[model samples]
Target: MDKQLSPVELRHQIRSGEFSDQTSGLCPGYTQANLVILPKADAYDFLLFAQRNPKPCPILEVTDLGSKNLHTFASDVDIASDFPKYRVFKNGELVAEPTDVNDIWRDDLVSFLIGCSFSFEASLITAGIEVRHITAGTNVPMYNTNIPTKAAGKFHGNYVVSMRPIPQNQVVKAVTITERLPQVHGTPIQIDHPETIGITDINHPDYGDAVEIKDGEVPVFWACGVTPQAAIMASKPEFVITHAPGHMLVTDVKDVDLSDIL
Candidate 1:
């Protein structure tokens, strides 16, 4: 697998079935997104839910019903085959994890691309912050917290968060750098206290790998794009689809393009 492929070329590989792997660290400077597809009947409620909670569900683009083309991301984008992997949900239970959504495509489905923290990982590495999971070649640790999202229609659930251990000295710098990328679930929602947020054992996470915390480092938590998946599971939506955890869509937009400070 070539790590330096451009977003266009990488997406092409995904579209052609030549590549099907987690997209983290693949397109280093490009933006990445989480995927969500739902029928038109549930579209308005989901859209309102996203708007009610922007930090965890920041909207990057929303395609029209019956269309998979995303105007702002790429002209040639194909939602069904663009991501390396997709998860299918029926009544909020995962029934299939496929490489593409070709067989399950529906005309009334609307696709949404939500901001992902992978867009900010490059910046974190550039600032000398150690993204332990990346260095360890593992998925970032994610957990479900007790924090409740504001109710929107029938969608209401706890927030999901991704964790990274930052060196004590670099914690402030991590916050300063990430806060600017608000469009991508910015900053540490919790810097040191895990128990305060209902996460008891940091070692066992609800999703992804558990990375080591070095001697002087403290765990930092950030709102995650997977919050929607949690909501889906909690509310038992009739039908929904999402990108598998860590398997994101590499967008044509550069990470810096989404940041005002850059």
Candidate 2:
């Protein structure tokens, strides 16, 4: 698959079932979103939660109830089918993982497009930083932190973070590159000390596989899009849908466009 495809083209491939893989490197220069679809009844509070915790839940666009088309992010994009994978949760438990959720579409559903770390990851790679997980061909390591997000209604939970191991020398440069993309979880929330953030063992991540931390490298952590999912599970809404881990919704907006506008 060509990783250089435009976001619209990638979404088309996803919608048509031509592509159904992790969107990490696809649509290289475009913004990729973390999707969260919930019942209209729960939309207000969820929006509030995102607003209060922008770092971990930076929202890009919110679709109206029952409307899957995100006019602000992409034209003619079908939320139900554009993402490569979907995680169906019922009363807080993940029930099934599906490639398409057309069978479960509802008129009362509200979709939210949250900014993802992939956008900033692109910036880091372009700046010549080695993203450890990408080099090792593994998912980035994520952990549930002790840091509590500001509560909104019943939506509340500890923050979840993604970690990347960087050489001590490159830490400053990585921070410099990522700091410019505030919409995409800007900068490292914590660096070097995993235990301070409640992460006991560096090798045992709560989500994704752990990559080696070289002798001169330190673990750098960033607020993750997964934080909202952790919040959703804690809240235990009657029904909720989210993009599967690493399977994000590609958007028409470019990373440079997002950075420039900000």
Say which candidate scores most in TM-score.
Answer: 2
Per-candidate local distance difference test: 0.88, 0.89
C-alpha root-mean-square deviation, candidate 1: 1.9
Clashing pairs in 2: none
lDDT of 2 by residue, 98-117 (tens): 99999999999999999988
TM-score of each: 0.94, 0.94
Model 1 over residues 32-75: C-alpha lDDT tens digits?
Answer: 88998989888898999999988899989899888978888776
CA-only RMSD, every prediction: 1.9, 1.5
Clashing residue pairs in candidate 1 are: none
Best by lDDT: 2
